[model samples]
Target chain A: MKHFVDTLHISGIREFSEMYINKEDCIFLTIGEPDFNTPTEIKDALKLALDENHTHYPPICGNHELRQRIAKLESMSFFESYTENNVIITNGATEALILAMGVLLGHGDNVMIPTPCFPLYQTQALLTGAEVSNYDTSTHGFQLRYHEFSKHIKENTKVIVLASPNNPTGIVYDEESMITLHRLMEEHPDLYVIIDEVYRSMIYEGEYPSIRDYESTIDRVILVQSFSKTFAMTGWRVGYAVAQESLIKQMNAFHQNLVTGVATFIQEAAITALDVDTQFMLDEYDHRRKYLLKRLALMDVDYIRPEGAFYIFIDIRKYGMDSYTFCKQLADELGVVIIPGIFFGTEGFARISYGANMDSLENGLDRLDQFIREFCL
Target chain B: MKHFVDTLHISGIREFSEMYINKEDCIFLTIGEPDFNTPTEIKDALKLALDENHTHYPPICGNHELRQRIAKLESMSFFESYTENNVIITNGATEALILAMGVLLGHGDNVMIPTPCFPLYQTQALLTGAEVSNYDTSTHGFQLRYHEFSKHIKENTKVIVLASPNNPTGIVYDEESMITLHRLMEEHPDLYVIIDEVYRSMIYEGEYPSIRDYESTIDRVILVQSFSKTFAMTGWRVGYAVAQESLIKQMNAFHQNLVTGVATFIQEAAITALDVDTQFMLDEYDHRRKYLLKRLALMDVDYIRPEGAFYIFIDIRKYGMDSYTFCKQLADELGVVIIPGIFFGTEGFARISYGANMDSLENGLDRLDQFIREFCL
Candidate 1:
């Protein structure tokens, strides 16, 4: 009977999940869950944690051992030198981003989110009573329109949220774009930069350069990374944010009263995920990414080629229908379910995840090609 | 150094952890963490999940098996019938409460809290920009003062927060008190009730009456429970809330954009925990609870005989020092750590957890007696 805040408009990932779960005959590309199993070494670590009685309350920030491991991992991989004080292991990357926005933005303040972005950023901003300003990248090949981004930054903008090897677009921010943004950040020293590097391990273009590489420009940077995508541990829900110790301390205060810590068993598993040699799936995802992009090209769909992560964003404007309607029709008429681009804030486009198995991918694309021929012709 | 919204406060639990963790010589009686290992059956369930590769994103609300188990368990033990649809599994009980407050309370709304309470209620209220009016129970033997509570209710008072078998006081609300509140709630049809039943299984007294026992109250009552205390699965970080389907839906929406869901392996472990018999520890806590109360009665200290949970609240006003300074001095001189009551608001008292091993409890109390006598004299 009581209505929740207006900000929380979407039901959940379940809303999307419900679309395909019961339909055994349907081929779904709508969900974001990875199809890989959790790496065996990580599973072994979890089993060890369970046997060793590491089931009592973990330290609120996290197990110091896990935090220390994460700190080391960040330093070695991203060249981001951070102590344990700078990392707060969270329930997931979603919580890390939500808490980051809660800590950085105040009522009436604003956060800059590039359109066709994960909806969580805008939703969280609204929940905190903060305004959201969008820079549409739909026309710019699904990459940040730097000039528009610069123009949108105002005095009230307190945070900027960016997903690298981005969610729907899969377009990793180029070094030139990051360098320009880093220089601009120098002028707006007051603004906080929240870069979500959850997809860091899945890049196809030989190691994506992190914003952390520009250490001189990182005083206000808060990097959110996760093991969910890389290790296929999304169900384990272990993620951490790397930032200045001061920012982390504030986030820890929130974490302490909010949720004590991520599950201790899961944290052990995450430590295993971080240290293990499990690039088999990362390479597999890259293969799938390239395969899907080539398929899209062959079908003559106008689209942005994803450089990293396993998703392709295609322009479906030629079909003369919005993405939501097109996706529904495709699913009903062709038995292939894809996520509408409008769900990510861009109309006239659709996102197809390449994370599914080879057989499904081929079949889904065949269904899509037939649907396009019938509808567009 | 940007100040946060002022609602987020550093928890006393963190303070206690910091003081006792690396201090090799000190004994701790402060935190609420359990000492037992997670039960083998529960651990195996988690291990099975890891082995079976259930590691990608689970349904945002929860895995169906876990939710169904929780629903069945609640029905069997508490005699409350709930479908899985009525449950929203959360990261922890803390997030269940957080989402409850976020959904039900609007800006400037008020919620009635019983004082000498878990500081979480106050902090959560502050985050939502709602007013928290305490019903001081210190003077009433650590139970809600219905007269004071009813006086505080106004048009803006939207919800009531109560932790049965409470956190600090460990006193369960009497049947008469529940009846009176139930009647009052009938008069205010619009008011929502958020009950934190995290310690439901920790009760050592008469039959614990959940608000669900009252037929008319079913729709408005939201029951928050955890796997932390009963199963010693605190580090597993799993909890759930059962409410009307509508409230669960709203909470799930808040959950999806915030923390998503509990870790999948952790959820599997929690379901096992729910199924296991807790009679052994429940009886153990009961024995310790009675012994601690008897010891407090013989000493020159002041305290209410707790009927449930695992803490004893002692009035330290006799020492003629403030709660914070007194607790710090007690920790230093007595080599025992106790959380200051000021951390839960108000003054001149200390809350000590009796869940420690019996040897530590006995020794800690002896030192506490000597320190109190020396200072008071």
Candidate 2:
């Protein structure tokens, strides 16, 4: 086995999910996927594609129509220069991040990612033979600060990864942070940023504060988007990345050999997904988010108010237990599963997902409250 | 950019296909996909899965039921010890190959492939920073000879990649060759073999002589299979790899972070695909293959009889032009597209795919004949 493969282990999030997936009556607040099913229109489109015999191999990048649709949708919020040529549909945002990392990072290069980030980013960076430099974000309420961001940069730093409506924190990067990141990129002309916006559509507040707002830094940003969250299509494994033509071309070369693009019929369906109304799912998640926030507050737990995505990272340091041990005991004793913050490169905290059903969330919170009282009080 | 990404290019086969894709009245024999639509049963299963709302994240390795079905199906032919733990559902055989390569190979290691071979193998090996060692098999009828294979083995050669009913040549390895390979493996205890059997089900002749027949060597053999060629599910992007439990665990770690897994509903549909009868499509391909062989014989072109896959590699050396020039001129002047042999790491040859309809095949052969008479004579 290669040294990297030897060092690589299954994601701790997956490890915990698998551990309790089959436990009777367990309420899973550990999932990162939306509980809702995919919309009917998208499913119908896939069936229609099947009826049309769209079963042959698609273009290496993706179907031209799907790329065009994606480009049009993204252009409205980001760079107007976006075109079909600037996009490559991937297996998922997972593959998109790996493709971007593979194209940009090599041996002796450094990829800086915020601490308490999506775990896959670290693993994907390591697979490319690049060193990972974690920019700890817990200090700034999990937001990017200009001075703190600059402190993590090294001469070998090639790429920086950020997630809007981040995985564990659920704190959307404010416009000020985006501007701060732009400043950092300007200082390091060679730096590229991979902005994972998989949770972009689920934001409950104002418009998504996109980094592409800075025209000068637009070319340096690779936007990773997915239909999984908003459309409840996680199993569909369809996502895309938008970048400059030259960079897109390089990523496409790796994408072609890696998975030969996403499923063709799925791409046709994704075009339909771009037009479907996702506000209903977002509304339901916001309802759950508010309820969960009320419950957590009554328990006197310390947590950042989640503005987007479906997670709330709550500090568990007061309980005097590590995140994994605390979550394990909760699942074992209370039948409520929450993800350990260590899975996202931070300890002494745990992430609770509001993507589950209201009943499950209610039951899970009650159990979590009881456990916290027993452990903390 | 990474040096390897800079070095990689879009496949030559895709380049020619794209060049002629929009050309009116062009007959394409450049595709490696089956012309048949995916079996109806599989498509219907996918539709049913959609109706059932099976659209959430599947297990990182794959859905448990699909893995069990695959293990059950593969065990009857390969190793009876095969279990669900030994299998990983991938995006396709393409991802399977890259995953196997990624897990087992690293910088300074060597990967040996027989040529003329699939071009992606070379690129994927290079992506892992491993040096690719091509053991040119064109000198030996594209079959493995014990002494010839041994000559290419280096001290650091960690993997040997082989294809049965191979992409360009359509030649299946015989039992004698498998025995010779098994003998070589006995001498090199650290060596691993990745046998790509994507076209395994399409063999028109006798049973496929798999390398896994040797129980001792089976542990080191990673078998890659696909539904694309067999059930005509190319656009579906589903395939699998089977290895010993330990190796499968390592590859699954990569698979989890790489693409998560194949689409969830697609895996459900793949279960229905396993029971699909594909003899009708195989019969059609064989009929076209026989017709193509007769046409080539009448044209007095040197070629090998394809035993399994739907391609016939014809020698174009007599035309006094390189493979690319000959193929380019054929498509431009005669509106017939055949893949240049150089795409598969050989020159002075061109590959004609019989995967197209008989009408296209007849017309393509006619155009090829005209080009030969005008240029070769």
Candidate 3:
């Protein structure tokens, strides 16, 4: 018997990480979940929602308040004019990504995705019976080159999944690249562009330029973002998508039949997140990113330095071991957990998240240094 | 220009109830939700979860405490043995149904669903690209006629979707029907059964004989139930499914990738719902069920008497209009809102929920009588 669809085999990086890591002692840096508690204001807002009897169903698309907050936030940050009708709150950016693909692609349609990206983009495409073509960025310092991306855009391409402060690699797309990408999107009027800016607030240097900046000029762009990273609310699982009203209508119908809506109480609480608490959490991540980068410099590791987000993709190829084996052996020997690069389809590197507390990071790095000296040498 | 799948159509029930109904005078009987607020204890539990900082990601299957509570509650209620491992909490019974269908049915598989049932069973099948064959129970007073059901069990039939204390008609499948269904299942080893008991606790009559009672002998049954109806926690969006280890394993994988689990605070609150305050809510539903049934009797409406849940399906063919037009005309003219029977795949009928306050029920019924006298005749 066929246990699962052939397309369902598109696996996420975490599966490979799970196989190599031991349960008992591995201090693994595998998952992308934020390590901080949900901000106090967001937590209190959730409590207020519950207290105020916001427990029944809200609108299937989203509650009006949260949608309004999302619209305001998008306009203020990206200068993109969006309305409540143009936004649909989702379970998370994961669901938003899936719904976007479902709305845009039919069977055998092709979607271009960045390699060394979050695996979900490609996985969702396969699940929809759509083919995923990867534009490998490993040689370009894990950055999208316009010519390379242009080569993959063919007649059958229905969508492109782009992530900024890209997952696993942590490289934010430069403005020129984004503009060039936007220009190409304009030429292909039939193609849908899905920009996952889930890590939008976590940028370290240059201002985040959203593809929505081209919205007044471009016809097809969908923005997917989440509170999970920005408010340390991964467990809270709240997110929203912004698109044209026409696209949102179909997404809303999918939302209606999929999960109805996020919990009303959660929606009410998330209003506080979008309005007040996200920046503070992002500031904390910025501090950690600087601290971890300094430590990497001291260790003399070869890394494509991140311009945004809290991950450092340090090359462990010099250590003469595969990324997965190195990650496990390092965790077993050093009492520290860092995800192997193999999970992100980049086998020679390992990704370390600086999202943990200073004490843990300091101690874990010290142990990592000791292990590298003993094992690599 | 085609935005939607060709096979899909917008649900007309939602279209009318949300759009056509007048705000000024609409007294809606089209409610698919319980009228009562979530119980104070459960609400307090939610508050406690927030206060104690339970805002982290719940385990993908569920929190252990809620899983244990579900195991205990359903085991005691149905005379079946279900360990925590056998249960997987979902967003709602809707999600449980979706996940069950996703895991069991690949493309081209056939799932037998009872007609005049909740539209989701068929919708989920459609989403999976599976064929949905209906067994019309309306002819047999909405009871599952074993001989008719058995005849539909051809070689291609992979599953059967059954609802007890049926949704639209409110007829409970009696013990005799359950025994015969069980016998048929015994003969067809390849067929899987998805029994939706979301309304099991709302029943007012003879013992709710669950397929769970035969779990020791039946290996292929999946039981789906919810806290929405029983505890008036519709907005809270928590439900669970119990099945054999093999099925739970596959469903758990999909559930993990789907929503990453239900909200933790809500799960904690639901534990209180299952363990502490369930009986009181069940008794209240029983009371409302009797009162509403009595009112329907006095109103001289032609209806199939409901055995359980808070709804009564009244045959309105006597009203001389289609269910959709009749419901709108009644709501607009008489200030009462009721769902059209066409929403649940049967025409010439309307489903009126009794979960509202007695005063509203009395007033609504009086208006209903007035509408019948003036409009129907």
Candidate 4:
């Protein structure tokens, strides 16, 4: 095995889950997938693609039809000048991040990301022999403080990764925060910023902000979007990268050697999914978010109100145990699953996802509250 | 962009094809996709998965039903001890190769491969910072002469890539040859061998030789198989890697950060594709191979007769031009397309795929003969 590969470890989520997955009957609050079924129109489109024999190698970037749709889609959001060439369909945002980093960062190069962000950014950057400079944002309630750039930014930092409606924390960056972030990126003209908006369509409290809205930062940012959260197509393996043509072309070149492209039928379905509204899920998730928040306000738990996505990150610092030990014991003693926030690089917290059904969330949170009472007291 | 990405060049094959793909009335002998559509049963299975709402994230390795089927499928060929745990379903054979190389190799490690092989291997190895040692096999009619392994074997050579029914050359390794190859591998227990059998099911001659046929070398080999070439599922994004449990676990961990897994509907379809009999395409390909051989015999051309797959690699050296010039001129003047051998690491030969319809192959080869008569003379 290569020395570098030995250094690459599985994410903390996988490590803890594997230890207890087969021991069923536990209410898993660690769910990242949505509980909704795929929309019928999308499935119909997939059937249509298969019937049409769309089963050969896709264009190295993606099918131009899908690309055109994605370009149109992005133009409505943050990119007015985006075109078919700007988007490269990927297996998912994960592959997009891998290709973007693989093409942009190398040895001696570095990426600056907020702590408690997705571990994928760190892992892929490491795989490319790049270093990571993580800004511990836990002190700021998991929101970006661009003024702190001088604290973590290094001379070799080549990319900045910002995830809005972030995993675990559900921190959605609005236009004001994004403008400051964009200004920070403009100051570092040599650096590229990656904006992960996989949960963009699901934002409940505020509008999703894209760096592309700022012309100065648009060329320097690579926007990644996913159909998994919005369309409930996690297993369909469809997502795309939206960026300037020159950057996308380079990323596409690297991507061609990694994957042929996403499956054609899946892409067709995703294209159809573009027309389907996501308001239903947003409303459902908002309900769940409110439900969880109401209960937390009544309890002794310390938590920041989740603004978007499906997670509520709660600090367990008052309890003597670390988040990992607390979550592990909670699951072992009770029948609920929550991820330790230490997994995301902040030690005194844990994340519980409300992406499950109301019943499971209710049952899981009840068990969690009881465990907190017993363990903390 | 990273300096390495800028250093990577577009392939010669693309350079030539792009110059002629738009010119009308062209006969394309450069097709690599099968003429047959995906089997109806496979399509039906994909539809079933979609209807069943198999749209959640799959296990990092794969869905157990598909992996179990793959294990059973592989055991019939190269590995008897293979299990569901040993198989990691990938986006395609491209990703399988990437994960295999990334997990098993690193800087200072070397991979030895024969010349005139797939450029993907070299491109990916370079991306991973591994050195490539190319052994020229054009002198030996493109067959592996096992006795010569000692000359290229180095203390740092960690991987040997062997492709049977290979791309461009179409040479299948028979059982006797594989046994000797196995014996050679047994001597170097430290080296990992990657056997790309994407075209294994398209064999026309005798049985395909696998290192797994002999148990001693089985543990050290990573077998890569694809549904694209055999089942015409290229656009479906389905393939898999079979190796030891520990290695597969590592690969799957890496895969988690690259792709979640193949789409669930695609995996379900692939499971049905397992029962699909590919005798018809094999028969058609054999007929085309025979047709190509018969025409080459009468033409004033030098060539190696292909034993399997859908290509005929003909020596264009006698035409008094490098392959790029010959192929480019042929496409421009004769209105026919073929890939230049320079793209495959050999300079004097060109590859013509017979995977097109009979009419196109017939028309293209006739024009090729006329080009030889006019240009060679």
TM-score of chain A of each: 0.94, 0.97, 0.92, 0.96
Comparing 1 and 3 on TM-score, the stronger one: 1
lDDT of 3 by residue, A1-377 (tens): 01333334424454654564565654555557677777788888877776777767677788897898788777775556778988998888877877787778867688888778776676566666677888778877776677777887888898889899888878888777677678777778788889998877788787676677775444488889887887777777678888888778887766665566788888888888766646666777778778777887898777878887778888888889999788878876666778777767678998888777677677777878888889998
TM-scores of chain B, in order: 0.93, 0.98, 0.92, 0.95
The DockQ-based CAPRI class assigned to model 2 is medium
Cα deviation at B188, candidate 4, in Å, is 3.2
The Cα local distance difference test for each model comes to 0.79, 0.89, 0.77, 0.82
User: Who wins the DockQ comparison?
Assistant: 2
Provide backbone clash counts, one per model: 0, 0, 8, 0
- Clashing residue pairs, backbone N/CA/C < 3 A, model 3: A27-A337, B27-B337, B28-B337, B29-B337, B29-B338, B30-B337, B30-B338, B30-B339
DockQ ranking from best candidate downward: 2, 4, 1, 3
lDDT of 3 at B321: 97
Window of ten residues with lowest summed lDDT in model 4 chain B:
B1-10
Listing every candidate in turn, what is its Cα RMSD in Å to the true structure after a full C-alpha superposition? 2.4, 1.5, 2.6, 1.9
Q: What is the per-residue lDDT of model 4 for residues B1-377, given as tens digits with 9 covering 90 to 100?
A: 25556556555566667777789999888877797889898999989988898878877788799899888878875446678988999988999998899888877889987778888888877766788999777876676677775677788888888788888898876665576667667777888889898988877776666677877767889989899989988887789999999999889878887886788778878888989898888898999888888888888577877777888899988778999889888988899899989888899999999889999988998999898888778
Model 4: per-residue Cα lDDT over A1-377, one tens digit each? 25556677777787887778877789888888899988888899999988998877777788888899999888885537678988999988888888788778888888888878777777877777788888887887676666764567777888888788888798786576677677777778888888888987777775666677787667888889888989988888888998889888888778877886888777777778889987888889999999898888777788967787889999888898999889899989896888998888788999989889999988888887898788777
- Interface RMSD, in order shown: 3.0, 1.5, 3.6, 1.9
Provide the lowest-lDDT 10-residue window in model 1 chain A: A1-10
